[model samples]
Target: MKFEIGEIVRFRKKHPCGDDRWEILRTGMDFKVKCLGCERVIMLSRPKFEKSVKEKVEVKE
Candidate 1:
């Protein structure tokens, strides 16, 4: 469940915008994530965020 800021992540559930992908903005007790489809920002608790995460997308250098 290790992740970093600026990493792209997928959730088990799709967003209202119909995208399941998100970009990690901030990490800690709460995670700040941005929706890739709608460009909306949201904050989710660590436990909630971790449970919903499907996978982390590899970022290219």
Candidate 2:
């Protein structure tokens, strides 16, 4: 899936904070995302990111 900055995404697994959703902060060779639950920022390699993501969340404006 194509990921754009500011878009929300859902992962296959939930975060430690108990949320499965994350907001995309940056994208490229590596991805920077913030946990929706804990508001923690994390960076993940493209490979790991693609494997972890279940879908790109479509948020209503």
The residue-level lDDT of candidate 1 at 16 comes to 91
Kindly list the per-residue Cα lDDT of model 1 for residues 5-47, writing each as its tens digit.
9999999999999999999999999999999999999999999
Estimate every model's Cα lDDT from 0 to 1. 0.93, 0.92
In Å, residue 3's CA in model 2 sits off its true spot by 0.8
- lDDT for 31 in candidate 1 is 98
The residue ranges of model 2 lying beyond 4 angstroms of the native Cα positions read 59-61
Candidate 2 per-residue lDDT over residues 1-61, each given as its tens digit: 6788898999999998899999999999999999999999999999999999998886535
Candidate 1 RMSD to the correct structure: 1.3
Native-referenced Cα lDDT, model 1: 0.93
Best by lDDT: 1
Query: What would the TM-score be for candidate 1 when compared with the true structure?
Result: 0.92
